[model samples]
Target chain A: MSTQTVGTAYRPSLGKRVQGWLAGRFAMIVAVLVLLYLFLPVFYTFIFSFNDYRKSNIEWRGFTLKHWANPCGAAGACDSLVTSLEIGLLSTLVATMLGTLVAFALVRHRFRGRGASNILVFVPMATPEIVLGASLLTIFVNGFTQLNGWFGTDLKLGFWTITIAHIMFCISFVVVSVKARLQSLDPRLEEAAQDLYAGPAETFWKITFPLVLPGIVGAALLAFSLSFDDFIITSFVSGNETTFPKFVYVSYLRGIPAQANVIGFSMFVIALALVIIGQIVGNARKK
Target chain B: MSALAHMGGGGAPATAMPPKEPSGRSWLPYLLLLPGVLWLLVFFIYPLAQLFAVSLYSDYPDYPGYYYQDVNWHNYVRALTDFLPHFGRSMLYAGLATFFAFVLAYPLAYAMAFKAGKWRGIMMILVIAPFFTSFILRTIAWRQILADEGPVAWVLEHLHLLSFMPNGRITETWVAVVAGLTYNFLPFMVLPIYASLERADPRVIEAGGDLYANGFTTFRTVTLPMSMPGVIAGTLLTFIPAAGDYVNAELLGSDTGTKMVGNVIESQFFKVLGGYPIAAALSFSLMALILAMVFLYVRRYGTEELL
Candidate 1:
């Protein structure tokens, strides 16, 4: 149809032009739907969080600041937020450091059984979170026998435990993220630094280390998000301790408070904003 | 230089190559390696070993070493019971999920990679934007969206497709779990496919077209074969864990039959009738299985990025 009278038709035949216009318009409609699917829930969560709904979710029941403003508010969103923050930061630090070094080892060294080492490092990546959580719990129980009695329960599950669990899985993400960057690094830079009589430490610090820092930073951020978002592993290892995800889990079943929506939406916005900022920074860096 | 000088030159190779800068640390790499190795071993390998040990014998609080000495290999034998079925179910869900994800992802990835026209960054961001929210909450929302009284149902009812609105709701159904898996993993599928497709060096396709081949033949012969590596990687990434996950089962599936090896392993570690050893045994077995396949694959393909 478009070829029927192309040169003579100015902008193709009328039918062809109409079809083209409709296709473009249809594409925009689909794009809008995809964007909506991507954005709606967190937006919904954010909007609903401001609602006064307690015993019901049928309507908004008017906006209220009670959920976010209240420090304790019967369910203690504040404490869990603090707890989640503490764990995320700690886990991020540990996973980033360890993962970076692992990437370093794979990239720099001509190690024995490197392939075997890689498999072992990534095996944790394949295993499900529940399995990991369960295994960690087993380790805590069977190994840490000396310090069991806490708050009348013969088990201890809280900050330290959750952090450790987060790190175990998170380190692998860091390793993969950093390793991808490391593989692209030029060995010539290090060789040049060494030829200039720089010490090995100095060479790595000036050349190799700086080159991989962005990846490390990205991995660190990824680890933070992963740890913050984790629910299953935390639940199994947490014993009696509760993180925000867990709190949301329990709270959802009992009655999803407007605070839950508020917190969820706020998280969504921050995450989206962070991603956008990262993209802008990434683009600027590229330029 | 010193290393070469030590090749029995009878005396430091005449010119003495800068006195060899005190080979202070052949130990540095190992030192760097120590902390991570220790963390993994103590927390990961050891616990896994312990779990295997426990699986061999039942746990009793009365037992001295935290497990019974019964030595029942039957746990391995019995993992075939409901366990094997869940494994099958998990794989089925993962398979369906990955299939759907690939189907959903391919055209989008294609458009983004080859046809999106300046909106690629936005498209890429859209692919990963789901990670911004908690997966569980998303699963819950999925439940709502797919529920009988929800949006899908409402739409279906309005469309007058059924006698009385057959509720597109499949919340606790196998389909739902797979839907969640597909939703979560669609990005995984897209990035790799788009990457491979994007890297296709369009000249090859143009050359094929110039050779009198049509679009389909060009895609099949040139594009598909070239993108196989990414296809394999993406499929493996989606399929391997999809086969192991229990989150979909726990959140979306109806019966225990939907539970996968992941759920069973998790249960061994935590659920009421939990068995640590069984969990370990199962995990080790699965790990060994994955390691074997991945090991063979790496041998064949020469990269460990399959995950």
Candidate 2:
């Protein structure tokens, strides 16, 4: 190191120094530009939230805060937001529960058909959303018709169908996320608990559950976001129900409302806050 | 929960186990797996099977929503013959988008992994923050950005680059759709490549320099090969979704000419009467094609564990 420093101190040429500096800053420059590219749309969305547009939101009008203050000024926007929220929460809860159990089964317990289970979990993720949505619609239509024929009952496609489809797609993502966390856990922690005379239930409730909670929470958040942001799948199964993305899609043909941008920015803010809080809490726990 | 106890203690020595085996509770694994497996079976597997069967059905001549199971298999032939151009367009657009995403994402991911130092966390947050917003909203934002009088077009016109474009604009063209896809799926490419690059040892890279290789040579031989897994994963993720996506095309591309297979499947499913068999067949074929491509790709570049 001393020899190298001495050599560099004696023979530092302008070309070499510039080359070294360029080499050092090259990746950083590219990263910042890439980040700007990524956030350009986000910046647009946030900026346009305040655009005072009458009908067509495609052009930049003068700015105002009315849209932000009255986000639900547009009809069906708030209702669709609520519908998306309901589906997100419900699907997240169900997918997280079922996926966590399946993840635990796959990671901790030896079982038959594990291969099949793994393949089943991965297929939904690998398949395209359009395919999944179309197939589910076919099944729902056929199944509901058969049921209506037999029991003289009318089961229509709406909220429940959308929720079911959301849960179905969300489960694979949940399992993948939670199973990663489960597999990464050190088995020695459970062994340590057992060595301390903690029974299985006690050990699980006290030790395993706490360790796995973060993964489950993360999975739930992922599932919720996925459910909320879905357009293609929900479009097929949601008969007349307008979720947030569905609302946005319809509004796109016309002009999207500034109120929609307000909602979009609001969601971005809430998600950022949650992520920051998660990071802070994580750091505090580490300390 | 004795089965839990037994499994928990199974890691210990034989003498540490209880003499009585929990034989009666051996079904716990299956019990734990029941709900998820059943859900997948009913919602995913069953629906796919139904879709395949529906694909074989023939629509009644005069009935709108009525169909008979024909097993004629002509649906596939007709779908392929009619929508073959769309299939090619989807692949072309997705491939171009994936390639461009890689070009943009590689340096960003590299900087995040190795050069960000104290700002890595901030960079990661920035990468994920855009994704948290509604996807449709972001695509809509792209419409504004790529509009005829938008900033992009203004800059292009000022720079004399507009003449090179087909119609002196970006929107309502394949360019806009490809750009939208690349922008939307950029993070998917970046994250995996970042992960693999982050896992690569700095010492191994430095060794290339020690062995008299220059920086570019070292990067090409060492860094590129080391990051291939991530590149493969990223490309697959971006390409798969881009190929299947209709949102970008619907929002940005020309309504009539630039339609992809996804748009066709979507329109058939929702708009046209007696469009179920054709849509189902198209979807089935798309899935089969994707699966085949992925299988070949993984065989060529991916590790067994990835599969």
Best DockQ among the predictions, by candidate number:
2
TM-score of each: 0.82, 0.91
The CAPRI quality class of candidate 1 comes to acceptable
At residue A90, give the lDDT of candidate 1: 94
- Stretches > 4 Å off in candidate 2: A1-23, B1-25, B62-65
In candidate 2, what are the lDDT values of residues B1-307, reduced to their tens digit?
0011111111112112122326787688889999999999999999999999999999888898679988969999999999999999999999999999999998898898788988987787788788777899999889889899899989999999987875768999999999999998888788778867777787887786455335666678888898887787778778988989999999899977789999999988878898889999999998888878877887887543343
Which window of 10 residues has the lowest lDDT sum in candidate 1 chain B? Answer: B1-10
Computed on C-alphas against the true complex, the DockQ of each candidate is: 0.26, 0.45
* Tens digit per residue, CA lDDT, model 1, A1-287: 67766664665445445544533454355444554665555555566667777585535579778877863564777678788889999999998898788767655565455566676677787666666777788778655575544334455677899999999888877777777666656667878999999998898788888887877887887788889988878987897788888887777667666665656666766877777798899789989
Candidate 1 lands at a TM-score of 0.82
Best by lDDT: 2
Top candidate by TM-score: 2
Clashing pairs in 1: A49-A262, B54-B277, B55-B277, B55-B278, B172-B254
TM-score of chain A considered alone, across all candidate predictions: 0.82, 0.91
